[model samples]
Target: MRFTFKCYATKHPEQTVIFTLLLSIFLLAYQLRIYEVPYFRMIGLKDFEQFESAVWLVVITMGTVGFGDIVPVTIFGRMITMVASLWGAFIFTLVLISFGSRFNLSTKQKQAMHQLVSQHKAARLIISAYRLYKLKRSKEGMGSNKSVLSESDKGISSLMRRLKEMAKDFKDERPKRRRVKNSKSQLI
Candidate 1:
């Protein structure tokens, strides 16, 4: 049964919500039944109907609204109400935590996306600066008029070399995976 439920939940998230709602309703109904049973009523409350009303009242209380219309008159009835209240509170808390976690995850994802965009803009700015510097030097006849442009060329070459080295380092750090064989074969 547990495995079947897990499979259903994995395959369909909507089904999980339906299941949870149904389970809550079933539990509420079962509690009502326990209250109505003759043996349980004999030891618990004045009457089963009163117990039923009390259970619903407790549900409302757990929802943070106290009507004060129905009250538990017996120790056993009060004990049942306390148990129901605690379970209801716990289920409600679980729901809040689930929503909170999703909100936190989405916020973190947005922050990461913003950081990536900013980094890309910074890289573009640096490349643009390098291009502008090159264009200015070329227009000034610094290289074509027999004047030494070695310093500027050296700077550009060094920058390109550093970029290449960084790329190589990144490639080296990547995980290696086996490639699948293709259907085509070549004759040597």
Candidate 2:
């Protein structure tokens, strides 16, 4: 377990997250001077007593919220806040990229998934077309029930619409399949 964590920590995502935490803590230590501001002193935040208020300030600053109820007073403290803001944004972006990369399928996996989807779409199109044809033939033979015929017309329209959409999906998939096959053949 420790070994796994060590390897994972070496990756960009984990490093950025850990760096963000460390940086935030460092900034918070630097901003400790801000509690001496008259406003904070009046609120009894001085002397690090019940320091959740300080934590809130650091977190809000890092998040770029800066709610103004609490703020860094000294020049160094303000500078720390600025650094936290930029670092927070940068870390968050890296974390997002990490998540995106984690979920990304390999090219071969994507190709296989697309092929399966294309086959399914083609099968659905064929089934819908067959159903529409059967409905038309039945309607012509059993022309007695007008309500049933009207319902069949609606069913036929719906099936035709579905077939058209599936056909389009199948057609759109052909180019992508060709590209995947070409790439695979080239690799071999």
Candidate 3:
């Protein structure tokens, strides 16, 4: 019966919503009956005179919290209690899966995100290399006539050039955007 309910719910989500609401009402009514009847035999209730106490018991049972305060003595009551606990677990699992899927990234989106991160890192390297190059050039002084490049300065220059090339490659692969004009801009 639980398997059938799950299959039907998966096939028809709109109907599942309605069925879930109706089932909740039915369970609440059944629990109320369990509390009102003397033959059902549930422990932990000081008094069965109030409807609120029955609702609380139903909630506690549905949550699978058998606080040992309330227990079903009859076989029928025990079956009902088990059904409520399993049903609650099933509902909770479904809700979590739906939410997880909603937030999950697709393969294409993940790839694009990876490309964006790589591009950002490349751009940062380019900027850092250019800054180092400028600092080296400034330290040599404007009055110096020497045109010779040290090994370290030559390496920094090569790194700066390579980073620029990588940045250009990344830019070429990025998607192009179209411009849209607002009403005010169109009027202008």
Candidate 4:
């Protein structure tokens, strides 16, 4: 899918920005911890040497990988992990819902689909109706069997009769309308 700023802004302006901001905040907090928290640990950080290493840990945690390379060592760090996990879940759900809404068909598109399906159904109904008509005519031609149609044949005849009535009802004959003119009000 191609990315457009307009689409992003129109779809969900606040959600996208807020989610990113929160994730950045988490990354920053973990990186800038003044002292060692027992539960949170960055494996390769000898003395908070690199910010990127902390970012890497945050990303993996947010992604729910939890590779065991870096872990939360203290109670405070554990609380951070819990918050991150909850945030990740919320963000994931939001992303899924957004994806569904974005890819869904527009009203006009859905209506067009409905029309196409209706047309196809009508075509099939017409074909069946025509087949029934042909069967009736062929039976009429068989004079010897005219008086003794099978149960199935009788059912088909009944169906054809109903279809004929339906066709008559659907016929495009409009009732005449009487137009009333306001003769009292003349445009002078």
Candidate 5:
């Protein structure tokens, strides 16, 4: 489901725009539901201005700004406004996510990035291997203490564990052989 939505948002920008517009329409309807003539009249707006007020309310409330230019007089209208504010926040989030999802690297760019990451992992593996070698030499120099593991031994253990995990993702960069010898010594 996440993959599908990512594809939808990144591939079809037009559809995202249409989806936002639909949400706005729904928000407008919700706003107009409770804000009748009396509600608008309290804000000194003429009854015909209800539609415009609803539009403004949707815009401001969706932005989470709460401009206070328009206030609902009736309790029902206020409650509806609060509910619409919450819905506005939700709709705003979806719209932002749809837009943000559009930013993505191209196929070639992603390949380059993966290659860089692989190289970094390989370099870290080499460093860990060198550190482990040094720690072993130090332990051997300390007269092979078999009684209790020293701090250097613990450090080597932790380093070995991390190296094991890092090695998992390191792909063999060497090319595969076209033919291989079987146990009988004949290429099969």
Candidate 6:
């Protein structure tokens, strides 16, 4: 039944979690048995008993907390412990690699997103400043006595051109806008 379940687990990932949990429980039970069982009474640790001890040892080693209370005495048991140690090291290295890769990717993405937002904010500030400057220049041109229209026209034209160029640059780098539609067919 255990072999059948293990085979099924390999093929079905959804079942694998449940199977692994059950298998872990079984291994823990077997580890208790091995710790209690008299060594002189047995010629060899049978298949089930050996498997249970090996799995439990691997779990303990992987967790990096070896309880020295359950040391292997036999040559076969020692060999199993050695293999479990190697497997535990490999599994831990893979976990660290995965975490590092994800952390680097997230940091890079965050930096890029911040740069894009800063660029947009700078463009907005430039446009607002240009608008205020134009308004001030128009008020001065209106009050002056000599050919105020021509001076006002030149100032307004230059301000408009600069604002247009800034708008273009901002549009090029702006994040794509998502349009939300209301039930009344209006876009928000």
Q: What number of clashing residue pairs does each candidate have, in the order they appear? A: 0, 0, 0, 8, 0, 0
Q: Give every collision pair in model 6.
A: none
Best by lDDT: 2
Q: Which candidate has the highest TM-score of all?
A: 2
| Model 5: colliding residue pairs | none
Question: Sorted by lDDT, highest first, which candidate order results?
Answer: 2, 5, 3, 4, 6, 1
Task: Write out the backbone clash pairs for model 2.
Answer: none
Superior by lDDT: candidate 1 or candidate 5: 5
Full ranking by TM-score: 2, 4, 5, 3, 1, 6
Give a tens-digit lDDT track for model 6, residues 109-174: 555665666577676858766785877666675765567666666667777776777676666544
Candidate 2, 62-166: lDDT as tens digits: 666878876666566677677777876776676677767778876799798988988898888888889989988998997689899889889889988888888
Question: Tens digit of lDDT per residue, candidate 4, span 53-122?
Answer: 5566566666677787766565666676666667676666666776667677655565555556555555
Q: What TM-score would every model get versus the actual structure? A: 0.41, 0.68, 0.48, 0.53, 0.51, 0.35
Q: What is the lDDT for 80 in model 6?
A: 52
Q: Write the per-residue lDDT of candidate 3 for residues 1-188, one digit (tens) a residue.
A: 99998898777755675567456736664665564556533544444445565556556776677676655556766776677777767765665665566586655565556666666766776776777777577646544444444554676677777777767766654432111113224546
lDDT of 2 at 53: 59
lDDT of 5: 0.67
Q: Show model 3 residue runs off by greater than 4 Å.
A: 1-25, 28-32, 40-52, 67-69, 106-115, 131-188
lDDT of 6: 0.56
Residue 66, candidate 4: alpha-carbon lDDT:
76
Question: Candidate 4's error at 67, in angstroms?
Answer: 5.1
lDDT tens readout by residue for model 1, 83-177:
66676676667556544554543434554555555566557556756765675566466646433466566666776676666555444433211
